[model samples]
Target: MKKQALSLLLALSLMSVPALAKENSADNFVRGKTYAGQFSDLPEGHTFYENVAALYEYGLSVGQADGTYGLTAPMTVGQAVIFAGRIRSLYRTGDPEAGPAAFTAAAIGLKDAQRVYAPYLWYLQAEGVLDKALDEQLANVATRAQMAHVLANLLPETVLPPVNDSLITQAYASRRRITDVTEYTPYYNDILKLYRCGISVGSDETGSFLPDSPITRGAAAAMLTRMVDPSLRLTPDWHLPELYSAEGAAYEDLVTAGTYIAAPETAADYDQAVRYMLSQGENTLSLKYDQDFTVSSAQEALNNALLAVKRHCEQGYNNASCSYNAAGTMILKFSSIAGDRTEEYRSETLSAAIAVHDALWQQGTITPASTQREIAWAYYQWIAANCTYDDAGDNTSVSHLPYSLFHNGKAVCDGYTGAYNLLLKLEGIDCYALPNATHIWTVATLDGETVHIDATWGDQGNTGTKQYFAMTPEQSYSLHPWPKENELPQ
Candidate 1:
């Protein structure tokens, strides 16, 4: 399937050759050592990795000789502008290699449009990635900050928003390695957080997040090494030659611990990293069961399970351009890709999962359940009051979990339902984990008919900690709509 997609993309690229004004390269992206890797001229130190690979496979970025990327080459303002424009094009019409046809034609100001590289001005303007810049000095030149803003616009709101103001303006600007605000806001934020943790460093100028200059590949890799495992500074094994540090016990430890398949330092290292992070070690939590264990033990075991689950969730998020917080709200490109799956991301999965064993012990005592509807009445109240009466005309599919939307807790739809199910399971009630077309919801059985219970709606409502659609099994979900052949696993 992967190979087939690549073939299709390559074919598309060929078909697009006539329409595209610029010559395409196969090897432009270089994976950074850190989340934000600056470009470098050197081979090992400067090749673009995953994103580049995807670009090449899709004909966005190609490769160079020696199987390396000239990532270090300075990016021009116009080039960066065009690159960003291409990303916007890919985002809107669903194909960077394809032409614009399915997109809604939005009006753009001619003055700001004139500043963009002519080749991509249309796409950028169409996607709203382009800022009018009409009243600002930047109206003439595109900066890294502007480019980052465009990416931010392309990405899910769950993804980090653009960074503004120099860190020097913040208390940490002096030692902060943050620079250039325009290109990679999330990476910048992650880098900002790390530097605040004393994991990264800074330039000689005023303490600030450059937010404009691109990062170096080597610097990026090193930062990734630090972010994933701070103990890497101490360990000795995971360290690679020349890459590993000695004398620096802290840095050396980073070499001793595990690596990431998700974060492949080298093609050869991908296997080991994946194994260590996914298949083995503490990164993957274990569930221990004792038939005779006390309720406290059970709680501890559950907490452990949750920790592992959180790690998995975080990793899954890392792989995706979208993500969910603990509340299960999702932030992603809802309208374009799969409209908001926030409905599914938050629903009753967790409730059902926990209910699997909540009755096994029947301790005859209460426990704190993490469901969105049970003890967390505050949670329910938040969602109910916050949800907008989703406009029929607004088809932009951006999604936010109930928790996030109301309480800044965000869960996707699945997360919302799963949380409701989880809480109800704790309270000893059977709720409906309903999956609708492109969405999953929950129906708590109400009095006689099943009432539609949406935890996300709960978050948007004004009620306190209670189900937004709570009732008897019949009222919440028993309406008998005659299940479709593919309606959830009901």
Candidate 2:
């Protein structure tokens, strides 16, 4: 209905990308081996978000904050560069119409180019993205992979593939002179990060970064190979191996990280995999569905309390009433673990709580609106829910672990905080979770005001208006922003 909510809904809808006929993953990607999770500014999602949130926070692919990423949007070279400087090495700056060339991040920030770049700020100058003279004007409008391709060009021709038509267009598109290109009105933090990192240089004589245009399979292959190849990235020259055979790696010199044979073979195999996955409907597609759980390190905290309920239930196995209360309570306690960085497991736990609550509601026991607090219930459920002194999951992985309401659950404080923090983020509500007297709760900003959200009390169910607190905007601002992630930096 509202513009923001409408935008949020649209973003949420893009998460589902239909499988493009499966293929042999062996040739394309190594599950845990080939891909490097943590890159540039993003510490890997650690499987915390299946499709959206994982990439969003890391600044790779952002979500609607209402829990949506335009996952299916056919990526354009210009739009893709947003993650260029941060996720990959690359830079683009300069006058779109002068002598264009690439430059390292540091080189472009010369005293003369402080507010603007020179003609040859080449990091991401797509060869023909725009008219040479006007290219420099379109800086900062490229995408991650687009910039990567531009930088890859700096390497010897043998190591780097030819630039694509789309990238060329994107380079030109971004260079359009802004009507009010005043000094100090622009922020090139993203571009600067890439340039300084030596990931890419500026454009050719007419400095520009084409930020529009559709990429082609050939160019995509070249760019993808270079990014994955460790050798190509390590080297700063451009040299493609002599074109010898019809197949095999004609572009091997430009790639260092991959052992991939070629795109045709890989794409074909991928198609097959997609077909197989499709045959099984969407269930087998791991990307399409979430994983179920066992009593892993994740459940160790809540299972202790569930164990008691388990034992009691054994005697009166099918008693619906006992089953509902015991399981429901455990589910609430389990909520503490909602932010386990494992959404699959968290979703499972939430589903259980909802199931129990739904049954109770059907019997006219719990109020309908009361379910609003289920999100909160999941928080404390995982935290203090029957947790023994030290549980494996929280002790080893998470910190500031919260004790459940009645020793009926287990969750490290990290999980609790993450759950609350992410929930607000997913809902597009700006909020921060805080720690006080060994307990955790969140402060949210909405309608120009701050609101306190205490999951512990919220999950406990309510009498009237019980645990939810609303703070004056100023009071809420006192709560610190969410903490950043820890990365094994490069």
Which candidate ranks first by lDDT, i.e. highest?
A: 1
Q: Write the per-residue lDDT of candidate 1 for residues 298-365, one digit (tens) a residue.
A: 44433322322222221111112333333323222111122254334323223333332233223312
Candidate 1 residues lying further than 4 Å off, grouped into runs, are 1-42, 45-51, 63-69, 97-116, 134-143, 158-208, 212-490
Off by over 4 Å in 2: 1-344, 356-360, 363-395, 398-408, 418-440, 444-450, 456-468, 476-490
**Number of the predicted model whose TM-score against the real structure is largest:** 1
lDDT score of model 1? Answer: 0.36
Q: Could you tell me how far off, in angstroms, the CA of residue 213 lies in candidate 2 after the best superposition?
A: 44
Tens digits of lDDT, candidate 2, 1-490: 2454345323322222112312211121111122233223223442222222323322223343533233333443323332222222211211111123234344444443221233233333443322233234333433433444444333333323333322322232233212121223222332222233333333333323223434332223233333334332221222111111112211111111212111112223323332332233221112111223233422332332222212111011101111112121212122122243433443343333334333443443433233334433333343333333224553243323222212234334433443444433322235544544344555555555556655443343222123344544344335533322210001
Model 2: which ten-residue window has the lowest total lDDT? 313-322
